[model samples]
Target chain A: MTFTTFMQHLVNSISLGSLYALIAVGYTMVYGILRLINFAHGEVFMFGSYMAFFAMTTFGMPWYIAFIIAIILTCIFGMLIEKAAYKPLRDAPRISIMISAIAASFLISNLGIVFFGGIPVTFPRPDIFDIRIVIGGVSIISVSLFIPVITAVALVILLYIVNHTKTGTAMRAVSKDYEAARLMGIDVNRIITFTFAIGSSLAAVGGIMWALRFPALIPFMGIMPGLKCFIAAVIGGIGNIKGAVLGGLILGFGEIMIVAFLPELSGYRDAFAFIFLIVILLFKPAGLLGKNIAEKV
Target chain B: MKRNNKLNIIAILAFIATLFILNVTLDPYRLRIFNLAGIYVILGLGLNLVNGFTGLFSLGHAGFMAIGAYTGALLTMSPETKEMTFFLEPITPILANIQLPFPIALVAAGLVAGAIGFLIGAPVLRLKDDYLAIATLGFSEIIRIVLTNMQTITNGALGLKGIPGNANIWWIWGVSLAVVVFMVLLIKSSYGKVFKAIREDEIAAEAMGVNIFKHKMMSFVIGCALAGVGGALLGSLIGAINPLLFRFLFTFNVLLIVVLGGMGSITGTVLSAVVVTVMIEYLRVLDIEMNLGFIRIPGVPGLRMVVFSLILLIVILFYQRGIMGSNEITWEKLFDFKNRIAKKITRRKSS
Candidate 1:
């Protein structure tokens, strides 16, 4: 392949990886706090895409403004989800809570189908993104550049919030031990909701970008990305923020390279993530970068 | 143990009577549904033994079922067809020409599925619940992908078609009943109690000298094997099989059923399975245009799923214990206090 084509693919991989990482962060964060797989997080991501679509076309807003509105709306919805479905089951057994999460996910999903319908709506690409930049004898879509930049900004902001902020410290403490943190006046519930909100907002950003790049939106679109992102989160070490990004980049690049290298195995593209999941679970149950959070059972 | 034994027999008798009455009275349609429910019961009971009883979260059931269904389908196909189909492949002349009977094929399916399950369970079962859930979920997807691509053995994505539909209404009900009986008898045994004890507290059970690993593996194997049987029956019932049919949604469906039925309640699981199946069918009927002269209603597509999902969410929110709690319907419990049937029988006898 030519140098330009190679750079194009590299850019594509980075963009793809960023999207995966963004979604993975949400899954990992929720799992970190609640010790429950928010099965509905995928649906939440789906909600973001639809919300952005409505904001742009239905409200006749500019693309950038619509995008911002979508992100904010999605984050608000994420907090609401925690309040309505998940908050009540705070003290329930972990398994029961997981079930509640799954139910909540299904509820959101069907509601989305009812409201938006299941038809694949083409997300309108902005004129600026439609332009092609020929950098080194290769043309790349404008949207490709934005994904990584947005992802990096989000990542840095998240790092600042998590590392430098007071609330972040409380989140860490509660995640480590809820009862102990609660005893220390951590306001564990609020922290957990904030974590979900932040993570979900990030996921919405990923989803909106994903729709723009792929240019197709379906209600069930989030299922695959959601699953792959979860796999990424697990493979990266569930609670580690940087690990989620690493996992997503690996998966996104790996899937693309696998398909590109072995053209015949395209059918097994979906299997690729699951295989990684199995291998990781087999060797490193705590994930590659995850700290030892084991209890004395 | 003595007290539990008396209670067990009474429950067993009552269950048997109920089965007998249902068998006698149920129409072929209801009987077919009951049979399917029974198959699901085996799956739920087996899974309950592992997840509910052993505290191992396995979601790779569809994988084992796929193995069993394919094996059964390959075995039961006519030898003439096999020769025509797999003639170029390395399949031996004796093997390719061999046509197994229905019963042998069924047994072969379960055994092969069990062996595959054992292989999958061996390494992965060592992981804790959350890790295991991801692994198992991956395992199911991998199985689907493998089956979809393995054109020689599985016919790829088109699925193993043209198989005989050997699952009569009686066969399904009979097999399902047999499985329920087997699980009940096994769980009632000393071994089964140990499984329950492990579920209650794995560390405590371990301290009390229970071999956690062995019991966990055993339950996983048995549950997977039953799923294999159910898959074979499903293959027959559907008369065609495709890899896409066993999606994450299929796994989600069963998970929903098990949870809604009260994860630990045996009767509750069976009842939940039947209710879910019938509910889906009923929803199909509900998606139609029916109205008076002044009102014109239109038939809506996919509304059923939307509503069904709503109902499930509401059920989890309001009736979370489902139709039954963890409590099993004991014979003693069934016969407790005053009821219309008991009073009527006594009055008739006295008169």
Candidate 2:
């Protein structure tokens, strides 16, 4: 491949990796605290796209304003779902909660189809994001360049919240030991809710960025990405945020490069992430960066 | 105990009577639904063996079903139909002309699916809970991708259509009833106890001299074999088979049925299979417009799915035990109901 083409592919991988990382954080954070897969996180991402879409088209709001509103709405939506569907089942068996999460996701996507219609909608793109940039004979969409920058900003903010804040400490304590965190005078429920909020808002950013990049909106768009990002989170060592980013980059580059090299395997692109997942689970269940803990009998 | 024997005989008679009535009275559409329900019963019972009794959270039912579907369809279809269906890509010469009796084809499908299940289960059973689940899920996706890519075998993404309709109410219900009986007997057997012990605590069961791998593999193979049978019947019943039809949605619906039936209860699974099947038909009304007074409500295409999912959530969140909660309908339970009725009559007379 020529240098420009290679550079274009690298830029594509970085942007795609940023989107996966953005959503992977949601999966990693929730899995870290609750050990529940939060299957509906993808639906939350879908909702974010639609929320932003509706806010812009139906409500006639500006793109940035709609984007911010979508993020806030998604945070509330995430917490509401946790409270209604997940919180009561907190003390129940693991299987039941997982099923509930799955049901919630199914419910949301189906409901989206009912409300938004099944046909793919054209995502409203603001022209500002469309501006193309060329560097050394390589042209990249401005959105591609902006996505990674946005991911970095979100990651920095997330790191600050997790390291320098009291809520983050509480979240860590709860993740370490739920009962112990409760005993230590931490409001465990609220911390869990907060985790959902932060995770979901990150999903919103990812979803909006995804819609901006791809620009086609479908009710079920989140299912594949959601599963892939979950795989990403698991690859990075599920509960580790930084690991999620690393995992996302690998998965992103791996996916793009596979098709770039072997176009014949393009039909099996969705299968690749899942195969990677199975391999990782087989050899490194705790993931690439995760610490292994012995299972208590 | 003599009374219990009498009750069992009566229950069998009642089941036969219901099947006879159903065959005589039901329309073609309703009969198809009934047959579908029976197939689901087999599927649910199969899933319960792994997910409920053996405590392996496998999400690969769709994959096993697809295997059974393609195998049975290929075996039962005549060369003419095969040629027409596989027009995009020619069927393998060996599979092109082959046709087996329905029962034999079903058995072959089961065996094929069971062999693959054994292959998948042996390695993945070593992984714990969620890891095992994701692994199985991945395997199912891989199966779908392979099926989609292998045009010679599966006709690729175009799918196989116009297979002869070989499944009927009798064949479907008879096999389902046999599966129910087999599960009931198996659970009462010593092997069932071992399976339950593994599910409850695999490490403890291993300590108790239960071969964890052996029992888990047995459950997985048996469950998958049954799933294959169900798929075979479904393909014949529907007269079409496609890779897209075997997506995770089918697995999700089966999971919903299993959960609604109470994970481990055979009786509940059977009852809920019918209930869910009928409920699915009834819910289709949401996709048809209704006129009330002067206003008309337009039908929404996907509203039924939304409602179905909401019901799943409500059931899981509130009635977590489902309809059965590990309970079974035995002869003794039937006798207890009789005793209650008799006592109520005696009390009224005394009053």
Candidate 3:
């Protein structure tokens, strides 16, 4: 490949990687705290995009206003999901909780079909995001650059909240030991809710960015990306924030490069994520950056 | 024990009698529903062995079913039929001419599926809980993707049509009955107790000299074989097969049956399988536009799935134990239930 083409691919990979990182952080955060896979998370991401879609198309809101409303609504929706589907099974077996998450995911996607209609809708892309820029014989959509910037900004702000703030400390404490955190005056439920809210907003951001890049809205569109992002989280060492980012980048670059180099294997594009997932699971179950904790007898 | 054996014989006779009556009387559409229910019974029982009894959350049933369906379909289809189906890409020369009897094809399907299961389960069964679930799901999807891409072997996306529909009510129910009986015998054996022991406490089971991995592999392979048989029967019953036919949604439907029937209970699985299969067909009313002379309601395409998923959520949240709650329906339990009701009625009358 030529230098310009390679540069273009690198830019596109970074954009996709950051998007995966954006969503992976949510999976890592929730898994870190609850040790539950939160299978419904993909639906939450779908909900955010649809919410933004309706906000723009139905309510006639500006792009920025619609995005904000969508993110906030998604945050509330995530908390409601936890309260309704998960909280009741807090003390139940992990498998039950996981099943509940799966059911919730199925429910939302089906509901999306019933409510939003199954036909794919074209997302309203504002003029600014639609612009293409050319530099040194390489042309790229402005959204590609915008995606990475937005992801970085979001991550930086999230890191500030998680590492520098009191709530972040409580979140860490709660994740470490639920009962101990509760005993030490941490409102475990609230911290969990807060973590969900933060994670969800980031997913919303990722969803919106994803919609911008792809521009088609389907109720079930989140399934593949959701699974891929979770795989990314696992690859990065699921509970670690920096690890999620690194994993996302590796996955994003790996997928793009494979398709670029082996055009004939494009049909197997989806399988690559799964292959990577199984290999990582078999070889390094703890993930690249994750600490290996011993299983208790 | 003799009386219990008599009861079992009587129940079997009654079941056969009912099947005969239904086969003779029911319309084709209704009979097809019964056939579907039978397929689900086999599928649910297999899944129950893995998810319910052994407590290994595997989401790969659909993949094994796909393998079985394809294997069964390829073996049973006439050469002429295969020629028509593989017009886009020529059929592999070896597979093109071979045709086997339905019974042999069905057994071959199960064996092929079971062999694949053993290969997959050997590595995947080591992971616990959600990881295992995801890995199995990945394998299932990988199987599907491979099936979709291997156009020569599977006819790719066009799928196969006009396969011999030999999976009539007798074949489906007979296989289902055999599976149910096998499950009962397996669960009653010492091996079954070991499976339950592992489910309750893996460490304790291991400490007690149970080769936990061996038992898990055995259960997974058996469950997969059942899924394969179920898939093959379903393909033959419908007279068509496709990779899309065995998606994760298919697994979810079977999972719903297993969960609603109480995971570990054979009786529950059978009851819910029939009920769920019938309910899915009945729920089609919601998908079609209805005309009430006074008011017209337009059809909603996906409402049935929405309703079914909501039911799953409610069952998981409130009725976690499901219909049978890991308890099978035994003669003693039935008799005790009847006596308790009789005693309650007598006491109420006396009072």
Candidate 4:
């Protein structure tokens, strides 16, 4: 509990928090527009990490190139998910769409099991990533500092696109009222695809960072984090991007701090977010930043 | 009332027959799996009440079950074994002293589980659909993580072992059958209609004076309680229980059962429970080595799980409506559908 140790843990928690925030933004954006949970986002993140792994190991590409390739493919893949699983069910009940998303997620994970095998594999840490930087008498892992920076840049980029762009306006319009947006000559389909692509790309970056930090990959890895990120989205107010980031940091840091400070109850750390989610759902059903989404009775 | 009367009699007769036949001609292992299936059937049906009938997406059934399993495990175990196996000091000494009979333990498990479900449902049931799903999933994980880490009570990761293995085929089947009967009766009542209306349109249901929160909690608790009974049966059948056994995979398996059986369909759930259990067990045969003359190959490990996952994927992709969709087995639909099929066959034969 000294200053140095506390600072070290803070850096660790922040890095972890940033990655969660990155993945969570994707969830919030998609949910904002489509009102679907995008259950496959976790798999998309997994896809990103695996793609990076292949780029670095099989192709022998440089670290940055590997990351770029992974992000590009995941973005395209996310859009495809919308095109394939969702478009057909556009007119169906939202439940069916959610179910379809779950199916797609299961498909991807099982496919991963087939291709990548069931065991956890180590992520390749580049030489630069292995180096730790000392600041203010605390040694921080290079990856630890790198994560928050990546998250901030991604958040800024997303904010700019959503606030200052035509596509963003269209997405907002569609989210508010699909029929109304359609009537206004908004390319509803294109906006959705773009939403999926952007969300997926961000998830890819999160996934990449997650791998570098946790340093392991497995088929079921997404199950816990995916659920937690969804919680982050909910806690921040579903469909609000900034809310999602805030929620993610709160959850990620909350989880790590619980485990770190309450060492005796470290095993219960994972449950902490879930307990918070339940409490939040009970108290502030709309979440921290979520407005009332008046349901049509 | 008419359908209820008819189904009640048929269910009772079937139960008697199953009890008679099971007693007359089945080994413990076969009976065990059948008992497991019955428990799962109950779990699926309970989940169907909330997720299927009420249109609430909840994924915390396992958490409810852990509560029930621990309750039942504590009740059934003797004081000495409880002392020797778990923590140095018994957390619930009353639990250690609770050498309740097997049937009592199972019932207690359901009740205790239902109570926890009530507590959890009060808070999380407000979240409808996907948010509710995440929240509930978190609840389940929290329950598990807490249960795992609470070495003072659940013995942590080492798991609670050597609980009384007294729950035979009859107990599981008896309890499951009772739950199904109870739920079916509930579903046919006026209260059930309100639940369905809420599912169809929550806003409209609320406007129409259906207390949405109450109905959702009712279903959620009942489902969770049944899942608890399932977990208790699982504990009894194995004679020991570990946190690892009830992983997210088990949740997915039960979910597949519900979806495959047809989300809101009781008959579909019963049928699919049989199908999935049999299918999985059949896949277990894949673990055996095979010889094809030219090249002999040993069975790959975890092949059954892979195959099961593949089947689940296929089901989700192509047969998402499952066997029955949201339809139930009412007498009119059954008789009318049967007659229509008969007439079609006769007409074809005549042609």
Q: Is the docking of candidate 3 incorrect, acceptable, medium or high quality?
A: high
- Which is the leading candidate under TM-score? 3
Candidate 4: stretches off by over 4 Å? B1-11, B22-29, B87-92, B285-294, B297-320, B330-351
Q: Give the TM-score of candidate 2.
A: 0.97
Candidate 1 colliding pairs: none
Clashes of 3: 0
lDDT (Cα atoms) of all candidates against the true structure: 0.81, 0.92, 0.94, 0.82
Tell me the deviation in Å of residue B197 in model 3.
0.9
lDDT of 4 at B34: 76
Question: Candidate 2 i-RMS (Å)?
Answer: 1.0
Off by over 4 Å in 2: B1-10, B291-295
Q: Candidate 1 chain B — worst ten consecutive residues by lDDT sum?
A: B85-94
Clashing pairs in 4: A297-B203, A297-B204
Candidates, DockQ: 0.58, 0.78, 0.81, 0.47
Among the numbered candidates, top lDDT falls to: 3
By TM-score, highest first, what's the ranking? 3, 2, 4, 1
**C-alpha RMSD of candidate 3:** 1.2
Model 2 Cα lDDT, one tens digit per residue, A39-120: 8999999999999999999999999999999999999999999999999999988888888988999999999998999999
Taking the tens digit of each residue's C-alpha lDDT, what string does model 1 give over B1-351? 677688777866786678788888999777776767766776676666667666677778778788778888778777666555554353454455667877788788788888888888898888876777878888988999999887667767777666787887666766777787787788779988988887788889999999988888888888888888888888877677889888766666777677778877777888888888777666775467768689877756557766766666666666767778677776557666447678999999999
